[model samples]
Target chain A: MLPPALSDKQTVPFDDRGLAYGDGLFETVLLRAGAPVLWRYHTDRLAKGCRRLNIPLPCQAALDATWQGDCTAELEVLKLILTRGSGGRGYAQPDEVTPRLLSRRTPFQPSIQRWQQGVTVRLCDLRLSRQPRLAGIKHLNRLENVLARQEWSDAAIAEGLLADSEGRVIEATSMNIFWLQAGQVFTPLVDQCGVAGTLRAGLIDQGVVAQRALLLDRLAEVERLWVANSVQGVWPVTTLLAADGSLLQRWAVSDSDPFQRLAHQLLGFA
Target chain B: MLPPALSDKQTVPFDDRGLAYGDGLFETVLLRAGAPVLWRYHTDRLAKGCRRLNIPLPCQAALDATWQGDCTAELEVLKLILTRGSGGRGYAQPDEVTPRLLSRRTPFQPSIQRWQQGVTVRLCDLRLSRQPRLAGIKHLNRLENVLARQEWSDAAIAEGLLADSEGRVIEATSMNIFWLQAGQVFTPLVDQCGVAGTLRAGLIDQGVVAQRALLLDRLAEVERLWVANSVQGVWPVTTLLAADGSLLQRWAVSDSDPFQRLAHQLLGFA
Candidate 1:
């Protein structure tokens, strides 16, 4: 089903609660092979987020009208943004409100080489604060991501992983993190913090990776690591380094590993 | 001096960093008579935030444009939104870009009774995380405030105060706070977290309040308490209660107190 369609033509008032307070949720979908990749999952997640944020779900008819149809080209991305309609200047939201939905298309092509060659990452000095209420959903409060992305200048560092206040590894700046431990794949739990990435959910659904509470002291034991997101797929980590320029860990994806095969199969890589 | 005039037909790209990643800074100015209140301080804070976030600072002409219009309707509110502008789909911003500046107008009327009569407050269950980098600036990453405001449905609670992970009172959801103790006023230090409110600075500048690290344990000793922001001015807190209905403290501003006079004089309250 297509998500609700919205544009400047829609009567979204300037006083939108979303614009005033960022009280909204959004999802980015991979438009591959002329359709939104895993659209059902994306919409389901958006629905769940709306439920959590107390936003009424939009009708399927309204949602279907959002598709641009020009997205038949491969390597395209679609984003759906939803927010509670305008309220007065105050924080108190109105009871009866129409949700604003906006959609847009973008051209994107994931680099298969980056996944196979393995990317380098650095540790961000900034730490994520624990917030159980707003955690796990792809809500718009992302100052932390913006700050972490600004931590490094070298184009070589592909991503920056963040830690919570207690020094526990949470996730990468824009993606979820997974590492090999005791011959099993483990990713951080998103209960108290962090977004539940769609790709991470796919991996966990396939029983390829398990969730665990990671400790800062366990970094030394992480053998091979990878970060996953819907857009980037899964990328291998070549070298992990601290902000002080000390090497932490490095890894290469085994060609015969299940994760590598799954990734290659999903992305159509030989 | 009036700020420069803004482009009336300017449109923000859907992929703008401000929309996608909340990478932006903002200032809410309270207009008195025909001009903005505390314009210099707001601009200074915005400039500081831009420097910290590595966003481009607007030129004098562009800055002046934010307030170069008629604003005489008894009371008015102006929001200056400065964004890093639009870019391709990635966290890494493009080089050689001009930040987008949008200034919008709102209606506001000062309620001195809310300030003088003292407002009721509730302790929010949501805690502000300590992020020293983005702590003081009124940047767009405000999921905490949105959630804190959602914690209460009572209009009687003018503001909800938040605490840090360690259970120390930080500030109200959108304002800075001060508590009177032993004929001295103390406000929490925002070096590690919380916004450095313009009104808070004015109070400190006028020698009516002192800045210090405040703890939750010290609330019981406060003889009077108040919250201040650019828009709300100074509001006395007559009763403070936690989320679980526990009494934290009681405060009031005596009609004859010198501090009350100072607040009225500083805020231009009648």
Candidate 2:
């Protein structure tokens, strides 16, 4: 059969293993200036996820073609999903598996307000499960994040920070986190758990950020903190709150923060 | 829409949360002689799962109607899926969430031989993550099971047993496991991990089986072991092998195995 028309998101069979078992990987790309921002980092992570999950990566054309739509919007979101295809005998994957790809574009509602003024973050009571094999890969098994995200509905709270089962601060509900302490920047190691965001990877790749085993207690000790992802850029977290809404730490976000400037330089964004 | 026709599985949107982030729950029930076996157990689990995930469960009419059809085949499998219906701002659930239901039926090929002449089982290297909130829900986030099931291709091996990250034996890739020792029956506690099977519940609820924390190393000490589920019935396990095919334990399954007899009476299978 021909590849689905660029618009038919209906091609995914209800039996697609992604729907059946979440046997898939996904990448939400920032399509700015008609091209995906940090495309290579997204590709690298997707490839790594596919390799780890044993789901074949789609051909380069199929991957590239997902973002070929009109560039009318300066900034948009490209949500890409690739599953271990339509047929599988229960949890036993098909012997000859073909991966299915689905992409959806939504207008990017830039969180510049959150980025400029910074945002209040909360400590989620729900801790993330540790699965090193499934960690770092943006696989579809994200109930932990969903549950954590639902912890608070207060509009002022922009993100919820998650800790691993062992009390190690992992990441925010939707983004990877990095903190500066005495001039050195560090993000939690995703090898044990958590999605390693493309922006986080770009920073690590550029040697500006380092990954370390970050315990939850260390969050209170950090000088400055920020949450970031491929779609929303960098969000300086000015306030941290306990689940009970008690104050933990508060900081003044600078307009010319070093990480924000570096992130802008890497993505070539205004 | 009128809750989809009993047959239109296609109504599941491609972006349904189940497919997007494993945000769903499922139950596979046994349809024997035009009726579902252990129906109440399945319903109880489904309701519990939906409540925990905050996915709205369909009313009695919609839930019951999913299986309103001719069950010509004496023994068949009914796969029921309930996903948090489409559309949400990423992982933050929609304020008003309606769940989508999908059911499919296939002939249940009874593993008489595996049941009568105990089948061999293998240990899996892929350890399950510990998430108490997700434990026992039988949610759609099942990549761990898929990965474990893929570990072996030997048709001789009927199942693979899984251990949680804490090195505790949780369950088989597709079934819950029970063992007999000194005339006492025990199964693993699924409070930290594993799907608590309907059949396992039947045994436990009957007060015939005891639940305890079973570690991976303890499996070798059992006198007789069996893996069971609602659809496949009960299969006596004769030999257990490590992931690398090293022998761990073996047992002579009896025609008058006490657990098998009780399970048969509980399931009411001829």
Candidate 3:
């Protein structure tokens, strides 16, 4: 679907930095009942990303206007992309910065089965590269995620887990992962890689999740695990598969009380 | 200037993977006298990039047709972007791959003064992240280069030298760098980071340049240094400045025989 601001155009400008060099940041907001869930968190992350990338933040009033004018879909996925705007050939930031704000809405396809019955996830062979500067911020340079997602084509596999080169588990391709062990919940620290997802942040802020460096080898010790993202609230992982598709670990979390409680709380927010 | 294939469009489709996740690769070809300089090298790199990224390579006949139909500009900078095509939301590769080939031509403006008198370069504070899988391919995930280029705004500084996080000198923002020491020419190994530039590859293939891991501390030992790219030819670095704009090293290469000979040889081919 066309972005609300760009509804009149069939495409972004050819010189858009977003297409040229991936010089942009994006936020995926879950829209329920025609209103964005955790919009403040999404905008906060986008603003923080802009501050780090040195791209000028779009005015809040402009964003509010766009939301009020275009947020009409009751059940949809909203994607807001802020690019450094069109510019000449070269890597240098343009002299007159005119940041382009694009908003797109798509029909939401809920992973209901995966969320209820639990889904299987496999470890991706592609290792996430360490870029502390770009880490945690949802910038547009997401080819690594694309590569990881391409590792498997099985419809049964709901997601693929990614790790850094050092064998430290990072996150799922498009979500934050959390493991429950000894009644403590742990999520991978995104300081060196992976996106600091909005739901993950909210959970952390609400004192339900704690960040820690997780090793791939330690997966067997986890009692229960689940993946979380804004669009897909939570999915308890029933199976963990190795890179070669060998079953590494399995958890009976489909009826676990803790898993259900956390998922319900998160889904309620969504 | 609009690409001949897309003169009527103001924007690329919003779903373009290149715009969405930088899921694409690009090649910048130097056009002189209505013909591409180093066309073989550029296409070779683009094809290699496609192979690595798993994006289906555009048919050679299609590429040839585009080149022939679009190479009408005598002096132009030709940019060819090949995206994984428009697709639905998500990181997964689309089921039906329809790669989008975009071509644009801009008037070539050679850095004549920098080429003749040499230019000053600075060590960028931003360190290039090592991602061996993505290294050396001219893919569209170029936020690192953009950040490095944004490190400096001085018009006098022609380029900024980038290094991996381990303090190993990689290359200039948009060009491959070479240093001459004891009559031996050395360029950074692109196995870990940096784009394996077309001109750099040509020189290496001709047994004129050798790849080596260069450290920032060893710059003082070099007799002469220059950066090379397809469009810019070569520019001897007359000064090396630190990230804070402090002069670290200076050289007189405008009259150096070796520098002039190499630059002339490279420029002649361009």
Question: Whose lDDT is greatest here?
Answer: 2
- C-alpha positional error of residue A218 in candidate 3 after TM-score superposition, expressed in Å: 0.7
Per-residue lDDT of B263 in model 2 = 89
Task: Write one digit per residue (lDDT tens) for candidate 2, span A1-270.
Answer: 234223264446667898889999999999877898999999999989988988777777888988996876888889988888878678998888877788887777676688799999999999999998899999999999988988999989999999999999999999999999889898999998899899999999899999887888878889899998878888898999999999999989886798888986776665
Q: What is the TM-score of chain A in candidate 1?
A: 0.91
Which residue ranges in model 2 land beyond 4 Å of their true spot? A1-11, B1-11
Q: Find the 10 residues in a row with the least total lDDT in model 1 chain B.
A: B1-10
lDDT of 3 by residue, B156-262 (tens): 99999998999999999999999987778889999988999998888888788899998989975688889889888888889999999999899986565564465
Task: State each candidate's chain A TM-score.
Answer: 0.91, 0.95, 0.93
The DockQ-derived docking category for candidate 1 is acceptable
Candidate 2 lDDT, B136-230, residue by residue in tens: 98899999998898899998999999999989999999999998878889999999899999999999999989998887888899888899988
Query: Lowest-lDDT window of 10 residues in candidate 2 chain B?
Result: B1-10
Tell me the TM-score of each prediction against the true structure: 0.92, 0.97, 0.94
Each candidate's DockQ score against the native complex?
A: 0.44, 0.76, 0.76
Between prediction 2 and prediction 3, the one with superior TM-score is 2
CA deviation > 4 Å runs, candidate 1? A1-5, A8-14, A68-70, A263-270, B1-7, B245-248
* Predicted candidate 1 versus true structure: per-residue lDDT over B1-270, tens digit per residue: 233224354445566566666678888888776577878888889989988888878887777666767875867888877777677336677765567777777778778678668888988888887778888888877777876777887777889988887778889988888887878988998877789888777778888889887777777677888888877777888899979867877765577656656765765764
